[model samples]
Target chain A: MNVILSLIVSSVAVFGLVVIAFVGVWGAHLEWLFGVVIPYLAVITFFVGMIYRVVQWGKCAMPFRIPSTCGQQKTLPWLKRTYVDKLDNPVGTVAVVGRMILEVLCFRSLFRNTRLEFGNGQEIKYKSAKWLWFGSIVFHYTFLIVLLRHLRFFTEPMPFFVPIIEKVDGFFQLYVPTLYQSGLLLGAAATFLLLRRVIDGKMRYISLPADYFPLFLILGLATTGVLMRYVLKADVVSIKELTMGLVSFRPVVPEGISVLFYIHIFLVSVFFAYFPFSKLTHMAGVFLSPTRNVSNNSRIVRHINPWNYPVKVHTYAAYEDEFREKMIDAGLPVEKGAPEPAKPE
Target chain B: MYDGGKIIAGIIIGLALLTFPIWYTSGRAAPKPEVKLPVKEKECVQPGPYMKKKHMQVLDLWRDSVVRVQQRSYVAFNGKEYDMSLQNTCMSADCHAKKSEFCDRCHNYTGVVPYCWDCHIPPKEKPEEKH
Candidate 1:
């Protein structure tokens, strides 16, 4: 039932994403709404939702040490245990940060992943699978670069470095029309990653339709952009005017801008709006993950549970005094004076 | 174990590999032909009201005769005019439409800025008419 419910929810979400992409791309006539208003709403929702989620997580208590560890724990000076895991001192914390850098930048865990399967002759086999990791790294890094390059669009006085980046990106000299290295790389990497999920039985089994939907939507956007570049050329002057207007918050939808342009913009808009709600929310969730941002200073400082309660106390001495007569009757030693003459009742 | 399911899976994968290229190339089929004009004409004149009423007809004829002939020519966005045979138009927006060449020539010469390529197709000679 849980799986079925998740499938349904993921399907609905993906379907909604597709609709949003289409509307955004073809709906240039409604640029003010999608380009300006929707983007504004998405930004607000992203911040508010992220803050809400982070605050909620902060309110939850963690009374136990639950840091996911990779190396050995620090103990006994000569034992050679991993200082990063056990002591968690400042230097050790830097080691953790170093590990995170490789994980975030290169998808280190993914690189270490292996696939287990039954081979010929009923033999069990484990095989290293690093293609997924490679594709993902390429996709993310190229995406970051492409996004940074787009900063040229938002700023008035173009930064000094943008031209240098543009020249470097077009260094391939692939055709009479200079080709953008990252653009092609981004598309190829995205395709490879998507194919891994669809073509690999194991990945497919674990994937919800939501996983496939974002991949497909992004693929659509990439394909359409390539088409605009290499095939059905559209008006550019009008496009820049429109884009400039949007960034300046004085949007004016140009008359001749093609529907394809709208489609590209729309897909991007959908990506932004759906970003905070979907698994893609990892963009924000990464900052909120307790494992990454929380300090690992368990040794230097104490974390007292604020919810601890006060209770009545009893000591061993009190117990002994209370049972002094009982102990003597039971042939046990007594702490105070022993037997005496019978006194008036 | 020579399991039947495993064999079937392998066969299915093999079949998919065979058909993948076909699907990819089919998507790359040429776009519909755009309206063109004659090579002899230096400037494309706006048509009269009567001729404008039949714009589609004029466009069809112009696309066949003029655009098909001069389609091989290329233009650049940089402030230098290079023959189409020497340089292929890849990223420039100046030569996107029929009137775009004039814009490209001037903009390329003057270094005037324009953002015509971001959303539009880069200009190219008609592939089918190459021969």
Candidate 2:
């Protein structure tokens, strides 16, 4: 039922985006909304939703030492403890942060992952599982670079670095039309990642439609974009004009922009708006996850919950005083007056 | 041990069966023909000033060609033909020279980023204009 619901929601969302983009591009009357208003709404939703989710996550209470660890805990002085794995102090916390950066940026954990199996005659064996790591790294890095490169679209004074990045990305000079490296890499990486989830039994068993939907939607966007560049070849001037109008809030639906461009833009807008509400929120959630971000220093300092309620206190001494004769008869130590004095009372 | 071995083999085969579709579907499912370069016209017929009566006509022709090519080469959503002639033009060396002037001006004015400049060669610099 969960899978069915997920599939239905994702399909409707993606199909709706396609329709919106089609209308924006082909319908002469609808261009203003698609070209300008929808994009603004998407951007606003993306920012506002991200902030709200992050704040909500911040409000969560983690009252125990629940930092996920893979190494020895800090205890005896002579024993060596892995700082990054078992965050014991400030220095250890910093080391953990560094490790996380590598994991997030380079997908280090995925690289280190291995698949275990039993081979001929039931001998246990381990094989390197690197493809998932490779694909994830490529996808993330390429996505980041593409986003950074797009900074040119929103800014008036073109940054000096934009041209430099453009040159670097197209340095390979693959064809009559210079190819942007990120675009190709993004497609390849997304493809590999999707394939891994679909083909690997374990991954496939756990996969939801949420996983497949993003993959399909992104692939569609990338395919259309590549086509625009090397195949159908849309009018660039009108495209820029349209994009600029959208950015400046006085959108003038340019006449010559292709429907494909509009579809691509609309899909992108959907992705931005959906980003904060979906599993994609992991992009922001990672920073607040207590398991990842908190330090393991429970021994060093007391962390009392500020919201804890006052409670009645009981002591073993009081109990012993009340049952001194009984405790003595039962061969336990008595903490108060003996049985003779209690009888007089 | 034999049971373990069987389980391992089953898992491997299962994984292979699962991954095949994703790999197969990576590229375009139905491949289309690659775009062919335009045959160079031998006559150096100069188009008029940017947005001028004659220049607009030539621009319109160029725009029409782009629209026609896009329509022929790609499929649009909603099954409607997209006329590329209505889209903006570029005046920079990046896009074709005759139609780009109008595009460059507004893009420059609004500070819009053009992806074409990233993927295509800039037009060759024209010689200095006579006073």
lDDT of each residue in A47-79, candidate 1, tens digit only:
566545544555666664455555555545776
TM-score of 2: 0.66
Per-residue lDDT of candidate 2, residues A116-145 (tens digit): 989999798999988788788889888877
Please report, in order, the local distance difference test score of every candidate based on alpha carbons: 0.56, 0.62
| Model 2 C-alpha lDDT per residue in residues B31-110, reported as the tens digit of each score | 11122112343111242222321333444455446656543222233354323432222332223343233445544532
TM-scores across all candidates?
0.62, 0.66
Runs in model 1 lying further than 4 Å from the true structure:
A1-28, A81-91, A117-127, A288-345, B1-131
lDDT of 1 at B28: 35
Listed per model in order, the count of residue pairs whose N, CA or C atoms clash below 3 Å is 19, 14
Highest-scoring model, lDDT: 2
